[model samples]
Target: MDKAEILVIGSGPAGLKAALSAAEQGAEVTLVERDPFLGGQLVKQTHMFFGSKEQYAAERGFKIAEKLSREVEAHPGIRVLCDTTALGYYDDGVVSLEVKGRFATVKPQSLIMATGAQENTLMFPNCDLPGVYGAGAVQTLMNVHGIIPGKRVAMVGAGNIGVIVSYQLLQAGVEVPAIVEALPHIGAYHVHASKVRRMGVPIYTSHTVLSAHGKDSLEKITMVAIDQDRQPVAGTEQELDVDVLCIAVGLTPLTEILFQAGCKMVYIPELGGHVAMRSDTLETSVPNIFVCGDVGGIEEASAAMVEGSIAGLTAARNFGYGKDSYEDQLAAARRELDSLRSGPVGEKIRSGLKRLSSFGEVTQ
Candidate 1:
């Protein structure tokens, strides 16, 4: 068993930020990552982030991860456990994990679950083929492992993940046939959409895959434009010869532990499914444990980092490990959170925040 003043699970942008913040506040922090390396999805992100300079926007995500890792390495108060998957959590802030092929348990005074989000899969005829993969998996293969998943690919979903991965595939010398979206317009940023468009990858709006055909592997795909009701229109079927089908429709929060631990949940499709109702401090229904990052909801890395900091600082304060000015530190964290959620896309997040805020009264 291992113990720390603060235990942060996941080691992505959220977990790293959480651990670093807590350490800076003089709390002993242990950061656990499921992967053999730290940086979670940040390592997969090869593109520059958007937002303000304070958030390291315009910098490539891989570079940002390197910088963050360096910070964590410099901090003596922070212990990073790589290749450790936190299997589950208990009500007493105790966690069970598999660490480098060994079983381990941790009981921390404060817990921050930054387990991040998982890909939301869409089902269609023959969608379960071997050549099909989540957009994130494609990234992991190309960016991390230096291996291309396939030569020609048809990406299903024109959202940010789909768009970004398509561009990255092009970078790695893979051909992207088309990005199919069931909506009339691309669901990602205009800049990302334009980048793929300029590269000659067609964006098929109001379209959905009818079937992905292949015996042992994916050999081709048939797609068609659909009406507002998502029913395929007649005579719009087109077959694209591609070996891979990448699904990037969206992400869902990895909230199984939160649910298992008996945290109150509210399902908001906009927020990407059942998330713990949290206070301004990022405290969940369970008072001593906090939830942050994509596990809270699917948002940008910028928002995830801010939320992680909020959870870490709040955790430190809860454990009586912070300075006399801990309240002021928390106030600063709140300001950071507010700034990240104040953009055009933030209107939807405001609704999520409102939903999460309601959890407090239910407990009282």
Candidate 2:
């Protein structure tokens, strides 16, 4: 069995930051990523990030990935295992992993779960068609593999991912027919909406995709404006001639390992599905285990990095590293977390936290 002071799973913004932070704190850290590459979702994100400069905001995600990877590599104590997927976690901090075409075991004193999230799916008429694809999948094809998903695409859901992917498609010289939203208002940040709107992309609010049309590949889409209850309004049906249907509803946390490890979870939709509950120090119900980033909840990359740092620092302290000022460090992390959620878009997230923390009676 491989032994380390700290082990981080996943290679997304959270995992990389956690491993880097732990190593910087003088802990032997090992990062395991399921993908062959270092970056996870960030590598497929071609758009710039938001938030403060400290978090590398306004920079392309790929650039941030490159910078973070370099920093992680520079840490002699940090070992990153790419293409190593963690399958399960056993008692006594034993983790089962599929590494490089073989199985391996890692027994660490502390663990940070930063597995991130996966795309959510919606059921609609003819949704299983060949040309209907997840927004992230399309992004992976274009950004990572340098291949266009389709010539003309109709994007479903006006969330950040959808809006950003639509703009990316345009940047990739693909035609975005329209952005359809079931809600009465835009779902993404105004900045993202403005970027696409200026490009003459029509955003249809109060609209929903009813069905996709095609035999082998998508050729057209049927959309309709819906009432408050999501029922189609009379005479509001329309058909858009497109080649692809891209679904970008949202993402659900990748919590399979957490479930396998018997970590306590709460189903908070705002947090993006079943998430492991953590204390102020980001420690899960299991004393030696922790979770951060999208795996704990769906926030931006900036927030994930901070959360990952908190988890790493706490884990390091738990294993006798920087034990003197552990409480102070955790309190500082909590303050920074509060600051990250002190914005308009963060209101919902704040509410979710309130509920998750049970109105602060717990998790405080």
Candidate 3:
């Protein structure tokens, strides 16, 4: 059986930071990534991040991923295991894994789940057509693999992902006919929204994709405006000729591992979808089973990094490591998290956290 002081499942922003922080605190850390490479979705993010300098603001996401992955690889205390899928968390505290098609098991004193999230898809007629794609899949194809998705694309959702991916598509010389959003207003940051608008992309609020049309692949799509009651308005249907329909509605926290571990779960829409109930330190109800990143809740990558740092520090402290300055580091991380979650953009996250804090009352 493989043994570790702290096992971090993921190699994204959160997992990378968690492994680094724990290793820096003199803990033997094992970092496992399912993909053959590190950096999770960060590798496909071509745009610059928005946050304070501490969060590496103004740096392109892929660059940040490179730096973090380099640190993780060079760290002597960390054992990097790429192409390893964490199968399940057993009742006896042994986590099973499949490393390159071979089964293995690791018994770690503490486990940090940074499994991230999955994109949410919209339901409509012919939505399962060939030309339909998720925002992440589009990003990977274009940014990572250097393949254009289509000549003309229509995007669903006006949130950050939709808006940003639309901008990226435009940069790649793809024609974005329009961006359809069911919400009454665009959910992206004003700067991003303005950029897309400046580029001649019209954002349709209170609109949704009604159906995709094509026999083999998407050739056209019908969109319609909706009322405040979320019902489609008659006579508002508009059809656009497009080859690709990208869905970027949102994401749901990937909490299957936490569920298998018997962690308390809660449904918090503001945090994306259902998430495991966690404490300020990012520790779940299951002792020594910490969670961070999108696995705990949906938020920006910057916030995920800070949460990873907190979870790592607290997990290492559980093993009596980092005793000298654990409190200071944890406090600093929390303050940074609060600052990141401040302002109008963070209102939804704030409300979700408020609801999560009162989980007992909510459940009762």
lDDT of 2 by residue, 1-364 (tens): 9897888998788888888877777789999989888877899887888776778878999998998988987789899899899988876668999999899998988889999999998788888988899998998999999999889999998989999999999999999989999889998999999999999999999999988888887888889999999999988889998988999988899998888787788899889988887787778877778998999988888889889889888888777787777678678767777878997888878877777897232232
Please give each candidate's TM-score. 0.95, 0.95, 0.98
In order, the Cα lDDT scores of the candidates are: 0.87, 0.87, 0.93
Q: Alpha carbon lDDT of residue 309, candidate 1? A: 83
User: Which window of ten consecutive residues has the lowest lDDT sum in model 3?
Assistant: 355-364
The Cα error of candidate 1 at residue 329, in Å, is 3.5
Off by over 4 Å in 2: 324-332, 359-364
Residue-level error in angstroms, candidate 2, position 215: 1.0
Query: What is candidate 3's lDDT per residue for 165-237, written digit by digit as tens?
Result: 9999999999998999999999999899999999999999999999999999999999999999999999999
Candidate 3 residue spans exceeding 4 A from truth: 360-364
**Residue 8 alpha-carbon offset, candidate 1, angstroms:** 0.6
Cα deviation in Å at residue 128, candidate 3? 0.8
Worst 10 residues of 1 by lDDT: 355-364
Runs of candidate 1 with Cα error greater than 4 angstroms are: 358-364
